[model samples]
Target: MSAKFLQILLIAMAATFSGCRNNSGDAHEGESHEGHNHEAEAKSEAKADPHAGHNHGEAPKFQYTAYSNSHELFAEADAFIAGKKAAILSHFSILPGFKAVEEGKITAILTVNGQESRAELSAPTRKGIYLFEITPSTAGKGSLRFVISEKGGNTESGTGEKGELRKRGNYEVIVSEVTVFADDHAPYHALQPEPSAVNTTVFTKEQSWKIDFATALPAQEPFGEIIKTSALVTSSQEGEAIVSAKSAGIVIFSAGVVTEGMSVSAGQTIASISGGMADNNPAIRFEEARNNFEKASADFERAKLLSADNIISQKEFTDTKNRYDNAKSVYDNLRGNFSRSGQSVKSPLGGFIRQLFVSNGAYVEAGTPLMVVSQSRKLTLTASLPQRYLPVLATVREASIKANSQSPALSLGELKGRVLSYGKAANSDNFLIPFTMQIENNGSFIPGSFVEVYLKGLSGTNVITVPVKALMEEQGLFYVWVQITPELFEKREVKVGRNDGRSAEILSGLQATERVVTAGAVQIKLAQATGTLDAHSGHVH
Candidate 1:
């Protein structure tokens, strides 16, 4: 790659790795290993040789090259094996032109053990060259021949010596790069937090609004509309009355049918009997029962009077009264149902009858829905709240609402509401708590109309604050990396409070003085995972 292109690629890499390199876990010092010298030694060795051939006989069987500095080429055997994985450190561009050469092109050659194997030097680019490996390939004095040509440069001969037994010199390729703390302006450390203030962030019950945030978080964003849950609502009466059959025969509503949805009203045709109801004697039986009840009633009243006058025993009076009540109750029930089947039917309350289960012609055994009537209609609004907000509202209390139909745009111009609410217990996998509110429809809201509910009397002032993006929650624990210096950052665990689904309240572990990572925490996080990012060096994160 061209130097400029490589530099460009590095910038992009720094940005990508910035997130991962540091955010994973480790703290970095940006320290690198020391460099070694090879250039001077090479030139000095060349000077000593003075163009005169080294006595093939005198050049040590094991000799070295430092690039001429410290002549670092080490050797042990006759030949060494190395793969095409070669690092070429040249003074000029040799990569592009060399790569242009034919594949497996021979750029270098080697002579070893009376058998010579050509080591090809290849340039993958004009600025670089890779030798199809030779040295270190075999275990001994690795050997090779140099036949490389450079762009705008002359083809040259590589200097190697013929050795006897101590299998000598191996050529060393040298590369150099400065290893120091990169400048804050070195195209990487821009926007790092300054280091003059305390290396901490602070906030309290006041000045929260002024706390420096890493970014903006808004609440106007749209959320999914809440779906409604269906329910049945009813009111109980002041009295409990029993409606039953007159005899042992089947008990059915005067109307033959029964079911939840079927509609019925007073005086409506319901059900009738086949045998007893078909004859006039069912009425006869009811009259007989009524006559017996009248006699019992009169006898019981007389017994009560005699007991009061001490003319009868208390036990006798009590027995007479019990018998009279039972007889009268039986008589009344028969009288009320005699004209119909032994079945006893009653009128249902009234309203816009919603459902009708039994049809006009379907037969029902007994206690079936002949029909039904509703007394009134009502409206309800249902919605979900984040679990954190569940505790702020009360059960069965008024709440303010804005409905499109009734108050177009809801102009109450006055604060009003009580909280009657129910919702899920906490923020589990499903973070929403479901709730419903009963609203008396004033010919305004419909059952399915959309509405917005506003919780009233909810108020708060200043509190600890932080940017939403800076907070990272893992395993329910929250943390943020605070930029502790122009070149360092410290990962800090924090306590979070009141997340209005936007900025969060920092209850602890963070403050206003330290700046936290806002936009690239993920990059820093991934880098930390792969051990590439230095958490200690303040940069992108």
Candidate 2:
């Protein structure tokens, strides 16, 4: 073979070998790409199927329930995982016979271990349902806290299980916890939109314990128009007596110690009066009169014997007899009252010594006004009312007296009294009509003490009422604290009608069977001003 032919053959063989090697490499790369595609497809399938290779084991299902102190409010939670977000479906309802809550404000929070995530709450729809969505940072052993605030047209605090919520002026907090699993591809059902919004104060059980709060239910009772006015307690004319000096003399207290307010009985000797050394002194007059009486009596007796025996003339015997009779009458009249020492001054009636006019060793003239004794068992209440109330004066069925602003009012029914009289016309000075009521004093009333009078007209139907202490006033507007729950209270505006200082009638903004804060209302007002108020924690069940 030629040399050139041999070189061409070698080149051809080398080229062929290189081409085969390249083809083999291409085949291997094609197999590797196909394997990678298959692996990716398998992974995508596993992720799409929720029950593929994942094992939940015996993990407890998520479940939660909530209720308010008001039997009318109820809530339930259904939790599940949806992709990377955790969704909670909340349903609320009112009892079968109660009025439905029109709308509510809702807030939700999710906590996993120590990590917390705020939830996006959807407004409630016509079905009264809400949905909460949260993208949990990490999934495993977590809880969801839900808060729902709702109000009715006539809703007030202390009316239901939402007590603490009412006090803090917050919505009812219904807390529920459920163990959940979190995963990016977890399967969860979708929920419809339900929109709502609310802001409320939360007064927790712990907070209530700190404040030492209490509550009471409102009641339906007989109520009437109350006419308020000022009054004066005075003594009745028949219940008073005046002691006066009977004659001119020096006064001396019978008991060494006689003071006002001392109890004395009828016929008790209060003092003694001794005549002074004057021309009209009773002691000297009695002595001189006695001497004359003795002389005249002896002369008359002798004359009488002579006349009967005809020993003296008739005219002389008659004159002597007349003188003796006259002197006898004088001695008899002064003998009982005129003693060498003094004359006794006694009380004619039994009562307390209300006043003392004469001091020890003081001189007093005859018929001079001295001291007054008052029987306080019976007293008179004089109340002045505006002329406008004159038409209802005769129809007044009840009355009460409060001695002072801080004192409790005493009712006429309890005191056993009635209206005695009323002025026919208004007074010239104040244009106020005066009315009097006689009261059997029970030792609680004091004469001359000013008081407040409440006169009630005829009773009407049963109405809601609360103690006066429950009311709070601001800028002439009246308000009250109603217990929403044991520890929760809400401030509410109220329209007040008749008030008797102890209790007031509610004409609007309050309901029967609702509870009110009879005490500590002022403290609540202060708390609202400082913004330190809180509501009870959401119920955990």
Candidate 3:
């Protein structure tokens, strides 16, 4: 026989003996005499074979390991040896970039004691995995090399080394173990909080110092229904006044630096008009009038002396006196105002420079406005409400005003203010009723600037209210942070009712006495999105 055929025959005979031993005890237990006879025949066959009674060495044992890029995909391999046959079971998952190998795509090379054997892949009970069997000539430590061919001509290869096998009296026992990689257990993906789940974010004492976090308790307070409307900040006619040019000339600013919003005192010379034609310039006209007045004065003195001496007629004396009086009146009018420069404009009131009508070098006609001075200490807030609200307008017990800047809104109860007046009838142009409230400006409120007015009515009892700063919005949904513990917070969605610019009324989702984050809410929102919150034991408030 050929050497290759002899090797195949030896392997087949070994497998036959292994199968007989497993079946012998079961069949012989039913009949003692028959079982004895069968055992005698098995012993005769084993004695006849030279390799039957000899130890061929231990059966091959395998250690299977698994690995994957993420927990979504898991890979495992089970390898063992039963009698003379070495079997390998490879399990794969269809992940994002990897696919399962087909029946003919797997090839394994098993090497034992310097001898190598190749086997074709076979299907297993489960899908997406494969199995194959190999027959080794001798028993020893073995290594399995596997190559899986992908449909796109790519290949994946792995090696199982230091594999051993052991044998028992009747059957070969195969042992397998598995291992997995570490990086698949990432914290962010593994420990994400569900949207509807109550998740507490832990802020350590050390981390809390880095953030400006503040909390306030929701309490039962007198919350009133607020009517919000746009309003205009204006100065009363008596509280504000404008400085105008008395004569037409070029405007020259008196101060080195003059701009709108600059504070000015009453009777202060803000600017002067100079450089005009002789007829228009008050300085030149005053000089000509003074010369005429000197001549008139001399004539009047002569007339008076002649009248006393009876050498001049009464009519002549009266005419001379009248001309002298007119000249003197004209000179006196120009004396105090005339200078080399021209007419000077003084501020009518002590206040800020509200407006500058003309530039420094610009020319102005007589009576042209130079600048507006306003006493900002007292101002008016005028709001136009829909005609339908006129019924409730009478019930407005308090009001507040908020500018479009960072300054906090001024509450009427804290500051000096009251509703001055309301229109008796709706305006014909906009069909909206106008209401006015007087306020003390306190240096921050600017005239003519638009502001928001909150008209609060009678307060309602047993209402939960929180500071407006405690609320945050995401995708049109309002939420607030409830302190679950001293250093932990949980986000909660809330339904909001009327807001009075300072405090907002909560209709749902919060209880009185529960502490909510009034500051640093944005920081907590960002931490929640990235899953950077540390884990801690927290109790709900």
Taking the tens digit of each residue's C-alpha lDDT, what string does model 1 give over 1-541?
5999999999998898888877653543553324634577677877986543433332111111112211111111121223222232212111111111222222544444435444555443322223244433222233333443334333332322211121123323331211111221221222233344333332210111122322212222212212222322221121111222223333334444455445556444344432344343455566678788999999998998899899988899989999999999988877676653333445434433344454433444434443334432444456666665555544324334555424532211222222245765744766777565554444544433466554332343445666567788899999886754312345679997654322456778866655566655554455455543332222110
Error of 3 at 12 (Å): 31
lDDT of 1: 0.43
Q: Which regions in candidate 1 have their CA more than 4 angstroms from the true location?
A: 1-295, 298-318, 330-350, 361-373, 377-379, 384-418, 426-432, 447-457, 460-541
Could you tally the backbone clashes for each prediction? 83, 32, 5
Worst 10 residues of 1 by lDDT: 70-79
As a whole number from 0 to 100, the lDDT of residue 429 in candidate 3 is 95
Q: What C-alpha lDDT, on a 0 to 100 scale, does residue 374 get in candidate 2?
A: 80
> Which residue runs of candidate 3 sit more than 4 Å off their true CA positions?
1-198, 236-239, 245-263, 273-342, 358-368, 375-377, 405-410, 413-418, 440-445, 460-462, 530-541
Q: On residues 1-541, what C-alpha lDDT tens digit does candidate 2 reach at each position?
A: 6999999999999999999999988877745554467678888989898568766443222334445553222333334442355445454543211223346566776777788777644456434446566666765666666565554533544445323333323344345454444542332322223212122133433343344454556768877778888889887777878888767888888888788888988788888778886746666777877888999999998998899999999999988988999998887766655555565677778888888887889988878767888887888888888888888887786787877777778888778877898899999999989999888888887887877888877776888888887888989999888765433467789999888777798999998867777755676666666664533134332
The C-alpha TM-scores of every prediction are: 0.29, 0.49, 0.49
Winner on lDDT (1 vs 2)? 2
Using lDDT as the yardstick, the better of models 2 and 3 is 2
Report lDDT per candidate: 0.43, 0.68, 0.67
Cα displacement (angstroms), candidate 3, residue 454, comes to 2.5
Ranking by lDDT: 2, 3, 1
